[model samples]
Target: MSSIRSPFGQDVEKQGIKLPKKWNDTNSKIPTDRTMAVGGGVAVGGGGVAVSGDSSEFPRKRRQRYVEKDGKCNVHHGNVRETYRYLTDIFTTLVDLKWRFNLLVFTLVYTTTWIFFGLIWWLIAYIRGDLEHTDDGEWTPCVANLNGFVSAFLFSIETETTIGYGYRVITEKCPEGIVLLLVQAILGSIVNAFMVGCMFVKISQPKKRAETLMFSQNAVISMRDNKLCLMFRVGDLRSSHIVEASIRAKLIRSKQTKEGEFIPLNQTDINVGFDTGDDRLFLVSPLIICHEFNESSPFWDISQEQLAREQFEIVVILEGMVEATGMTCQARSSYLDSEVLWGERFTPVLSLEEGFYEVDYDTFHQTYPTPTPTCSAHELAELAKKGEEIPLPPLTPPPIQNPNQNLDGERGRGEWDEEGEVESVSNGDVKKMDVQH
Candidate 1:
């Protein structure tokens, strides 16, 4: 038998009990297929499936499951169904059953148990010759006026409830009757305690808290005051509020160690409502929880392309006390990469009608396209630091041309005009005679 350590430091046998495995063990071996399931993470190819490139084919293929019902990635593993074989899960089954069904089952079981004990009481009374004769010579039982098994049954009920009706007293003559009465009383108390305890636990479960706690259909990664931040909306569906409400977020990613050991998930806590350093917020209306992608953030270096391809989940947990019931309640939801809408803003879901305030649940899942920077959060911050300044080279002047050296030829002094015509000269100018006109 497998053993588990109890709070008292005792080894308790855990035969036929299946517990969730611890995922962060250092020496655990990882399957080859899970390491390269997504994120192009593994160095060596897994399953010879070409882990580096696209993981899906364009053609229509057989039916397959991508994500599990609990929003976990099913590409590598799925949740285990049955936890325990038989009796250990009885309490769980009872608590999960619907109230109507539980009430019916309790009624049938209680009635059957009461009748069974009553029959035993009647058999003892009949076998002991305890039926008395009335003053009119008619036989009448002491437990009831009727002279049948029902008289003893009614006496059993009265005795089990500790309601003595005087006439049905068990005398010293029937010692076994007294012993049966004691046993019946004890068993009645135990039955009541068991059923009532189970009903109380089922009715007051924390899952009721989630019915009023609403989550937006999609999460958004958008620009908030020029810095990138991831946001999602949450609201209370009922008029009654949750007191001292607080919220938390976690970024869950799969990781592999250098020793080739894989952790199914690695969780990083994110600060919610960091503006005031307090995670508490009034949830009377819809609240938008923000986690900025700062230097220390897990998503600080993530680009838009990488973020789209990354397989990770953002789980939001809200915890608070119900104002009406005065009990602590928690609600949680997870957002996958595909559910994160880029460059979008949530539409307003709260509005004023006449003088009264109203919330439009129809618009709770709605979002509109928004103008956000195309660059990553880190890149945008760096560009903002650079500022908007343009540098130019200084202007220079052009060169001036000289007019002293003319290409036109002039006679040395004057060329002789022999026949009123200019004669040719060695320098392309003939001896020019001064022509006086």
Candidate 2:
């Protein structure tokens, strides 16, 4: 049986357990697909949490997406027959529709209302005997030159649009027609205001503004301020800035509690300097946002090796007001555990140029290898508590000096004199010793 290092600081056997494919060796070639089906059990705390189904019965456990990479919710309502709910808030419903659908609805609304009024105009001319007396110039018809449905339809268009072609002017012969004209004019204005507002709101949506606010392709894990931090870069492509921008992150992962309660797609908040107010960013240039792996961090237990066996997603959210429009905008992106690079740091992409600082977007996602500890933050904290000292280089010894040399590296002036042993260094007087054999 193969052994797996459990996160609980123990080795557990992989017997009768089916691990997710991405949880294998880090150096192994992993599949690009983040979807996985783990059918068996995970060894936790020396116990196997087995599933109740066999391979044929269960087949595979599909992982459902809570939030897509683009920050859209992956939920859909089914079997709800409350059609009136959408009708109650019809304006919002129309605004949320796709461009093609909205355009079709916009066209149909005007066409249908125009036809309904055109049918009324046709019926009025027919009942008033105006259609048969079009050639009788003495007969003042309710609508001049009106004879058929086609003319009525054209008249409806001309009236609603205020074209006033003057050929189909309404006469005072039919006062009932006068009342219909006033009603149609008021109804036409209402429809115009409603439909045009929907189209205008749809066209000016702030969703597209988020496209200019870009997030880095990948997130990184490296040493920062003597702590392990998860980092990602964000920037704005437009010259106009995002006012009062702030960023937040969430860790999405499945968890099994101590009581064996399984919680799928659980989300935990990842602090990106909220306490220190670093979450509020001045996004003039591309800035690397960092989340320190402190005691309260979700990634505190994730080491470089454990990272390879971890399957979790980090969703980053950036919210700010558009400086040009004064409207709030939000941008989002996610990084799977596979996208995180350990023992690496993002390269410098900002440089000083003439008159201003220049930001290079080309190298925004580029990173280079750096020395980082492979241990988890918890393990490092433990080591720190124990006061463990890192090994240092060996010390060197001083050079040896000859006794015959003075401090200046010159020969001593106290040499044996011819008369007696006269020792004198520098200008000191020599004391002669009588040599008695």
Candidate 3:
């Protein structure tokens, strides 16, 4: 038997350990002996038996490889979170105009310069009293030819719109023309200053940016008696500033009348309000119940089928601006008939986060029903006359009849009995019995 030491220096014996005996022969020299197993311990002297550690326990060496840094991953990364953060940053930054002051300043300067130049040219033309011939041969102020006031004004307008119609002509021949050109040059210098001032005012105005107010569009199941109810959400996109906002909704429908073709019916205004909140606002409005479906109203003529096939455009006008310059936002939707169920009401869409909203149709339709018509006096009279002629449907006869009798003769006798029974019973009881039978 043979033995070898392990890496930990433990002596492992392999003497009579059931290794092949021929492998233990001392003189059996062979070149194949060089392939003999070592340290794992079963061995042969010449053509040796081989032995090894448990294959499952084989030691493995780890290798290192390069990984690219281009953001590709083998697992799901929380990318949505990062995207949301980026968007939040953008919105927060854009919610205020302070960051874009440079652009605003440039615009203000540009607009003010033209305005001033136009004003100066008009003043010069008024003072100089230069005259030109018009198509009708009348003398009109030659502001362009003498002082170039017309040219300056035209130039100012052209710069404002950037259209450059190029109609007015100015010459540097006269002192008046030279003076007008100087005025334009001065006007250009101050235009930027005036614009900057205007921009400052605009930024200072109390304007409210659009905000995401409500969580979701949901139905309003309860409301004040005899009133329609609606709900909306609003919010300020900015964190620090407060937005004072008012909301109005209009219910518009197009229908044909006897006088002409399709015309619109606009309901009374529905108003909502919001006070200070953390970038969020809530609003509710009471619908005018008096305008609800009734026989005398246009709503009575509308049907669920018609509504489903047709579209109803609900216009929500939001009145508020970020600075006080009176900015407005509008939301519109075309509702399908299936969406407007139950009665005829609807709920405004809401945002899951900020600046989003949806509509709630189920609640709106569940509350409003189509109106039923009532008979007019003239129609009632006609019906009464028809009833008289019908003769109370000729009293139904008793079942008793001769077997040999024909149906007409039997029916005649039965009518007589039925009439007698009707005369005997009270009118109320007779009607009740008639219904019961």
Please report, in order, the local distance difference test score of every candidate based on alpha carbons: 0.61, 0.73, 0.36
TM-score of 1: 0.64
Local accuracy of candidate 2 as per-residue lDDT tens digits, 1-437: 45423222223232333335343566663333333534333222222234443435544333333455556655456456888999999999999999999999999989998899899999999998888898998998889988899999999998888999899989887898899899889999999999999988888778989988888766888777788899998999999999999999999887779998777667899999899999999999888899999989998999887886566778899999989788889998877665687865666667778999888887676654445688898887888789985222221211334333322222122234444332332112334433332
Residues 1-437, candidate 3, lDDT per residue (tens digit)? Answer: 34322222223332232223244556763332132223223232332344445533433211110110111111223325455665566433333457477476466656666667677666655565553333333444434433455566566676445465656545443466567666665665465455555556556544223332221121221122322233332333333332344444455444446886445433434333222222123233222112223233333344323432332333344444343444443222221112233222222222244665433322222221111112222333355568742112223433555433322341111122332332212112322123113
lDDT of 1 by residue, 176-276 (tens): 76688779889988887888888888887766766778887668877777678888989898888999889988887667779997676677888776567
Superposed model 3: Cα runs more than 4 Å off: 1-185, 193-208, 211-244, 264-310, 321-437
TM-score of each: 0.64, 0.74, 0.29
lDDT score for candidate 2 against the true structure: 0.73
Task: Give RMSD to native, each candidate.
Answer: 25.5, 18.4, 35.5
Preferred candidate (TM-score higher): 1 or 2: 2
Ranking by TM-score: 2, 1, 3
Best by TM-score: 2
